[model samples]
Target: MALMIISSVVATPSGNKDISVAIEEMERANYFTFVMLINMVPPNLFQGNVTFLMPSDRSLSRTMVPAQNSVMDLLLRHSIPSPLLFDHLLHLPTNSMLPTSNPDLMLKVSNRGRRSLFLGNVKIVSPNICTHGYSVRCHGIDGVISIEKPGLASPITCPRVASAAAPLPLLAPPSPSPSPSSAPASDPPHGAAYETSGGVRPQMELALTTWMAFVWLLYSKAKLCV
Candidate 1:
């Protein structure tokens, strides 16, 4: 079936220039079906930053075109909320997930190289086709991206290893008490030398001096008698 293009102009408050430039770029790339799909959607949706993952005309011709009411959902699922260039997409590692404009949908990346980048099931055949627009960018894909269900396995799988319990801290042994002989001696208190029991050497010296004086007196009396 031939896809119809709406010739009627849709009024937009701003960002008309970027969208017009982007649509022109898509047309130049011969993505007429995608351009027609873009025209069917409201102009306000394309006014914000967005990246379109456009399926090629040959690929779209094989599948059925989306209905008028569901066109917005199809477009949103194929687009990213933020403007991402082909170079930016190459930075995403394999198995990384990108959130689509639809909150419930996610695009799984399989980036092997520049030529081998795949989003979901669709591989980007043409990179950076709509780079002329500031807020809009697009890349042509080989096929329509498949929507992943929320119940499926998560994009990243972390291994579940049992966490080992933390080890207890070691306590240091108490130091041994010093023996009396090994201990250092402190100085005696003042006036301790004058006490009777503590001053025995001083008392003996005083008695020896008094006995020598009495012996010298007895010798002088014996000399007088001779």
Candidate 2:
């Protein structure tokens, strides 16, 4: 943004004047709110040859001030970048569009004879409040011009976000099965003859041999007696 240095000078009838004089005229016109608003602006702004559309005291008092970011936008909407007086504006045909400091907004002129002149929705109640200088000009308007936000005029669209797909979960391995041959053996009953390694029991065989020998001895004794 370029800086506008306002230098004060007296306004001559020949279209030569200063910005400070114009501001003084605004104070005299009972536009205290409008004057205060302009004073709030930094010295570096609204620097070039400019025109101001000031709202009346009552109009400014009733309306709330715009936010800090919006204050510049609002001021720009009301002002024309070039110096324009009531006479210059009067020549414009009906529906003539005038550009402001802000490119998005415009001031439309509505000329309806001596009774009324309008810039957009607000009527120029007091025309040419300050025409003392060639660089600065001011006029009193009936109401405040509605400020349209640049963001709202052209809607901002958000780009689509790409999301990554989720990863799959892992599972555990299964256990091995047991073999049938490894099962336990069954138990045997009590008092049964258990199998030995070589032959039959020795006690039964000895008893049979003794009985045979006794029989033989008795036979021999009987024979000798006869």
Q: Could you give candidate 1's per-residue lDDT for residues 140-177 as a string of tens digits?
A: 99987766544212444332222222322333323333
What residue runs in model 2 are displaced by over 4 Å at the alpha carbon? 1-17, 147-226
lDDT of 2 at 122: 80
Which residue segments of model 1 deviate by more than 4 Å?
1-14, 148-226
Q: How accurate is candidate 1 locally (lDDT)?
A: 0.74
The lDDT leader among the candidates is 1
